[model samples]
Target chain A: MNDAFSQLHPAASFAFFVAVITLTMLYMHPVLLIISLAAAAGYVCILKGARHFGKTLIYLVPFLIFMSVLNALFNHAGVTPLFYLSNGNAVTKEALTFGFYASVMLSAVILWFECFNVVMTSDKLLCLFGRLSPSVSLLLSMALRFVPKFGRKIRSIDAARAQIGQGSAQGGFIRRVKNSMKVLSVTLTWALESSLTAANSMKSRGYGAARRTSFSLYRFTVRDAVTMVLCAFAVGVTAACVVSGGIYARYYPSVIISGFGGIPALGMAAFALLCFLPQLFDAKEALVWRRLRSAI
Target chain B: MPQTVKKSRVTVTLTVIVLSAAAIAVETWLWSSRKYYLTSVIIILLAMLPFFARFEGRRPQVREIVLLAVMTAFAVAGRVAFYWAPQFKPVCAIVILTAAAFNAEAGFITGAAAGLISNMFFGQGPWTPWQMFGFGLVGFFAGVLFGGREVKTVPMLVYGFFSVLIIYGVLLDTGSLFMYSQEVSLKALLAMYASGFTFNLIHASGTVVFLLLLQKPVLSKLRRIKIKYGMLQ
Candidate 1:
């Protein structure tokens, strides 16, 4: 997980994900969808390795197909009917194409999100939010910390219950439910009580004092600046193209894809570059590592 | 400090209204652009902002912040614990109880935060905002309805059932339509709802069951903490 892109400032990586995911959701053009899906797949494969990528695709592809078929079944619009369902609704080619396009967009968005989760860890999120509101960020950080703690407590409580011959795993459904409830109740009381103590400790330490500064490990470097600039440029180019109808598409009476060569191609290329920037960074890092090894 | 809080509240309200109006305008203008999910995500984010803004303006105490964090974490843990049981998460029930014990604002924050943080483990996607919105609304309405009251088990279970079924279930199901549809129509929306009905029933039933089991002891504990600490009055 030593990807160069993720090593950038949290804001830089977060902005990139926002741009790519927004574009993926907004664009219905077939070429753009394919480009996004390919870039997302490349990023995921590089980020999580090939085997993980294959596993995700195995689950995702079927979902994509199912969604597309479901869309076609539900929606009976447009000209150029491909076939008719038993309910006498015409299955239009336009609807089917649109369905597939939507599915690709969804899959691309999902894959990009996978990359996002890997890159944007909890501390990164806290850092980003800390800049906005320290209170909210503190809450988020505490919640993040407490999730694991609470989980461990729940397990311990369950174990204690089992030790006392009151295991939730034993007995009928009602009894099991009651036993688990007892476990949850004890855990809840402990959480609330301990959290109050934690609050007191913070108060003793002057938590709400004026200008209470929080520490963050992330710092914006030269590399982050360059990555942000490139992402902004790509986003600007594609947004202009989309706004000006250069990458226009329609799927109603018929499937129409206009602005083929000039602006549309440029937009798609920009989008591809934007979407694949992480992979590019990873590749460059790998190349540098290899060169260093050779010199050594 | 009170004046500053009032001023900030006004500013937050204005900002939220203006942002919501702009979002709606863009959604309408881009009606044929097939960016339903994008606009919806923007709207959802905008909707959550005011709650955070208010919380920030209040200069809340450490106890309040810690309580919110603990509640959010517990809800997330509940979801994780029930991961193997599809649609059987105690998250909704926990959220409802949180709202009932605290204020609507607290409930909203806990539910929304839990939705987000839990997804950090479950994997996030286009559906994250919708889930956040759904859970937030469930918590909010529960707080509005039963906050600071001794909620009986039967009523709590009933509310839990319907809130999950309607608020969370409908919001998520509708989100799927926006995500997966090129052109939304009544027929298509109905189909989507119908397809999701079984899953929604399971989720709602799970919520009811959790609420039924958890109502008395959880509420009593929350009441004890609230009185003992004088929290979030």
Candidate 2:
């Protein structure tokens, strides 16, 4: 109903991402991986809708299976051997489990990044780094904007070339490739000349003559502050647990996972809470909106 | 102005040297300790920080920043254009051309930016840092070898071949090794390299093809723009 998490302070949103992604990569416990994957998928579905989730799955499922099988084929480092490949490497349970873990971790990271790309827009990145390093931030934001602009320009160039009977998709594979290179050369020239004008315009506006001040729309609200503190506390708890071997796991030589209890269980709970914080906020906002509408 | 420019150059050179040494030391420690995930993250951040600091201190002109952004965009667009072919992208060629035309720092920024922004389409994972490092090094070497000079076709082609190998064969393979094993072994390393040889070959050939076709025109056009705008001087 309400997607208010996206409106949080950029620092809050960015810190959430940095914390979750780092933990997802570092904490290899299967339970943690599963929890992260579920939360990441849930967040992505909420942000981009169900159709995008379906598309992600279409690409991700086969990739996960492929990685698992590849590892099973090549890595033979476990106590329990399932089978022997033709290349003489024994497929072990540990290898298979490790592959599953790796794929889950990889996909979870990727999904979180998808959410990041949607929520942490280029302007946020600029705002985050603009004060500390204006030039680098400018380059980052410009690069982000230019990517889509260049994509459109390439399409227009291709279309125009097609009208002249010299398009990239004209003939055999080689011919098409050569034609594409031609299109690329034309685009390169155009991009260079246009960038010069853009630069000159910035210079005329007194760019680099003094310290640049940027206008920001983001404000750290009370809600954002609460979210930031909650996130930091959760992340700190999880990191301490991980560092103290509370959620320790081993795959090679044997799949021995530490039993969940005490600090380890607490760590897992904190991590799950941290991962689901945005979703929980969104759901709460939706419920409040629905109640308000009913009262109205 | 000239004296300050010279002084900034010296500072940049010193920073790069010190950073490289620190990177090697950290890498040795990482390999010895096998803290692959955490340590590699630190190392990657370390690898990228000095370039940003160098740029901040030198304060590149607006035109140079714009040019770097455009070049990075072009490199990304090139990758998108050839998406039909796996591992066959013109990014390496464009990076080399940028390096040869501009200085190493600009080249590194372009290459790193291209690797990063392109991942927005290709998907990000642990492979990202290695990819960034590979492209950045390719650009760095090209700049060191032929910055502001006329790049001969034969030598440029050779460099293109080797750069792609380093990217796919060495850097990406190392990333794969880390992903697969907690501890590194020579056998695993060799096996990974052997398995990726064909993909690396295809990537290298693509670089050679693009470099042969795009080098002269791209380099000449960039040089003209640089001179016309009084950029990166």
Candidate 3:
């Protein structure tokens, strides 16, 4: 985020990052999941500033921990046993370890996407997929931006209804539920009326015309190319690692892995750098935002 | 003018019928050749019917219209997603729950469509039509909630449980039917899948859990989804 390398051309970088994380999931470490979780935390901290990291940490840490534990319990996988089940299934040390590692991979994938979400705004996204099912993509992307607003509008409508004594507050739980249904139905009708108005407006404005184009401004540069190449190189390395089993070095209770972490770790660090490289060149926007905030 | 709206709707219907026919043709070709493709083309046409059709008589509310489409899509999708899982599975409990709130038609459409469309993620095969029928039945029963007002839950849950039970059970038997290379009796297949009753229990329990957790959220959101999407008549 604020790593000064984050504000760069984001399209290829984002897809590149997602690709690497997804591919790495094919072969990764329990340590890597922890690292990913940590990186997620770190990435958030970098974005919103260290002050907000505490709140983010509070919310995500517990969930990640819970997921890790649940995966370990349910997914009795791996080659070496750490413990024996009462029904005689062994929790292979490898399985438990791999589960934990996979969790890290999952965390990385998630955090990486979150980073994309923050950096790649809707305007950027529209530009990214210019060729594919344009309508569907536009609609889905709009939904993403609009869904929260949609939820908010409903809440506000309900609150307004309550103010007008239209709420389902009386009678038994059953009756009250019935009333809520009626209220929701009425509210939905009102909402639809408004939507129709909007749609008609769109029709009048010639929204269905073939000439209309969704446009955005985010140009690609030479650095973007190098960054892409570097990222792709990392992706290739990640794939090569997974296929060759270089990504996950294991120590079964009986089997130990040593002297193997350095290369993959270096590869990941290189990727993180490429993914964040955009920020390094774009000082103006961040600086302006900082200035605006200071003035506020 | 309202007349133009009617005309437009009529035109859309004729177009949809043709489009649907075309899609079915494509599907039939695939079915004949590979016996499997995703259920997108058919499920989509089914989902869009209310949107395109102009009911001059009486029309369902926008919520009903959207929910109908969603319920169709959800039931089909959920069933398809869990296809390879243990037999006698519960999916599309949402449809059951919602239909119980509303009526049998809603439930049936949701379950049927959900079963059919969710296959789009993977491939649709010989089992699509059977799953479609199975889920559609679940929704149909759910939609028949007795004496419930705008909001119905108890009936929804009951309907969801039983409808899902039948849907999943029949699906298992029917699945066995499809898995066969040639002709086989339903009774024989049912006997074979009769052993999967435990798995059915597992599936039913899972669906019930999902229904309980998701019903409130989905119901609350359904109205809003209708409004936002301009699914009103």
Candidate 4:
């Protein structure tokens, strides 16, 4: 599943994320919210496995509940009063429902970002932005690469310090903090010195002598083109429907939801398709692989 | 070379001012109408536009790029290194030092890049953009206020104190306010700020401690490196 999604052109993948995440954040209709949440969760499970799904749910459920409760307590702008808070504000059904919608939206967006972190590899990001902003892209990719390298350096430094009995663990709280700062200062100095050599290496390589060119493995293939067109079509239709007031809901003063009918239904179907496009690709790839395996 | 550098610096400064002004105008309009999603997207794009403008005018040498990347990475690593200390990280101080030693442009890029890359491990969400903005502004102001100036510990510490307040106090609190409420209200905003005050204080103290302890050594080393390499001139 991961391989299937990763194999798509970076542009296509980026478009898919932009479309789904934008809609997930903007579209407040209950139907669209549910669809987005389910699709985001399903895709996350496919990409990250079930263990991560459980972990995310554990964190998100409480947060969702908390948000809903907070809104129910504070916001009293509704006709349907469930109860009155001690502050004399009514805990209205409309507020609770709105809170629930917000929670779902927040969770769905977070899930999409988690998927994005997995799918949008630094190299792919570089590929996407390199042509548009070469120096910024270079810096971004370099920063991404250096994070883990710096982490390793910190660990090694910590180990060296600990062996000499001046480690963070070898003292009281204040002393430990001081010790850690010592290690951090050393790492900062080392990083600065090493950067000079790095700069010199680039200088020797004739970097910035001319506009830089990079080797790219990704190509916009037929599949990528089709997927992008499909995604764009779905996004366009959904946006048109939204602008046309097909997917409309009101949570303040009164909880009013527009009737689900022709255009709203079509818009929802398109949105669901948009959110599920990656999963569809993953499923198709798996089926093909399984068939080929059985034949062999 | 110096002229070109100065020209680009002027252009970068102008772009930042223009974009921020535009963002403020957009934000005012959106807040009145309550378009939170659009506000988020617009602000993030606005925050990032200066980087492209700055680099587009004059392509940064690979040396500067690598150095900026390494500094960003160190800032991020510093954040993770102090994970044991809740709400306390040297990231803000590192960003301030980077901006002071280098330029505002490098400072903004380093802060933004660090916010983004660190969120990969910490978890990315809507808060990510606000975090990036908060940190980026810290770097930008540091550069704007203290760029190419002699190091003074007291002023740096004061700046660090306020920068942390803006980041953890104002920016993130506003994010929660929007996330939790459909409609904006003064009471809710006050409540949100009150709730987040303790955490912001911790973050502020962390920034101050890191600045007080690190400003001299880090700035001196970076200054010496700049002289030796003729960098960020």
Which candidate comes out best when scored by DockQ?
1
lDDT (C-alpha) at residue A254 in model 1: 88
The digit string of per-residue lDDT tens for model 1 on A36-122 reads: 999999888878998999999789999999988877887787888888989899988987888888888888988998899999987
**CA deviation > 4 Å runs, candidate 3:** A1-10, A29-38, A55-92, A141-164, A169-175, A215-217, A221-223, A241-296, B1-233
Give the alpha carbon lDDT tens digit for every residue of A1-296 in model 3: 34554545667656655554444343334434454556555665666667776765576567557655654555455666667778887766654554455445555655655565566555554567543434333333432333344445556776777786666776678777666655545544444455445545655776645534766665687766776777778667645544454454553333344326766666556545544444433454578788999998
Off by over 4 Å in 4: A1-3, A158-179, A290-296, B1-33
Q: Which interface RMSD values do the candidates have, in the order shown?
A: 1.2, 2.2, 11.6, 1.8
lDDT by residue (B180-210, candidate 3, tens digit) is 2112355545654776666666766777766
Give the Cα lDDT of each candidate: 0.86, 0.84, 0.53, 0.83
Q: Over the stretch B53-82, how does candidate 2's per-residue lDDT look in tens digits?
A: 878777888888889999988888789878
Error of 4 at A72 (Å): 1.3
> Please, what are the lDDT tens digits per residue for candidate 1 over residues B88-195?
998998899989988798889889888888988898777888998899999999999999876777777888989999999989998988877767788778888999
lDDT of 2 by residue, A1-296 (tens): 23688889999999899889978877778989999999999999889998989999999999999978877876788999988878888899999998888888888988998898888876776788889998877877787788888788888999999998889989889889788878878888898899889989999999999999899999888988898899899989987887787778888789889947899989999999999998899888889999999999
Candidate 1 Cα misplacement greater than 4 A, ranges: A171-173, A290-296, B1-11, B30-32
DockQ of all models, two decimals each: 0.82, 0.61, 0.05, 0.66
Write down the DockQ of candidate 1. 0.82
Error of 2 at A20 (Å): 1.3
A best-first ranking of the candidates according to their TM-score comes to 1, 4, 2, 3
All models, RMSD in angstroms = 2.1, 3.8, 12.9, 3.2
Q: Indicate the residue-level lDDT of B69 in model 1.
A: 91
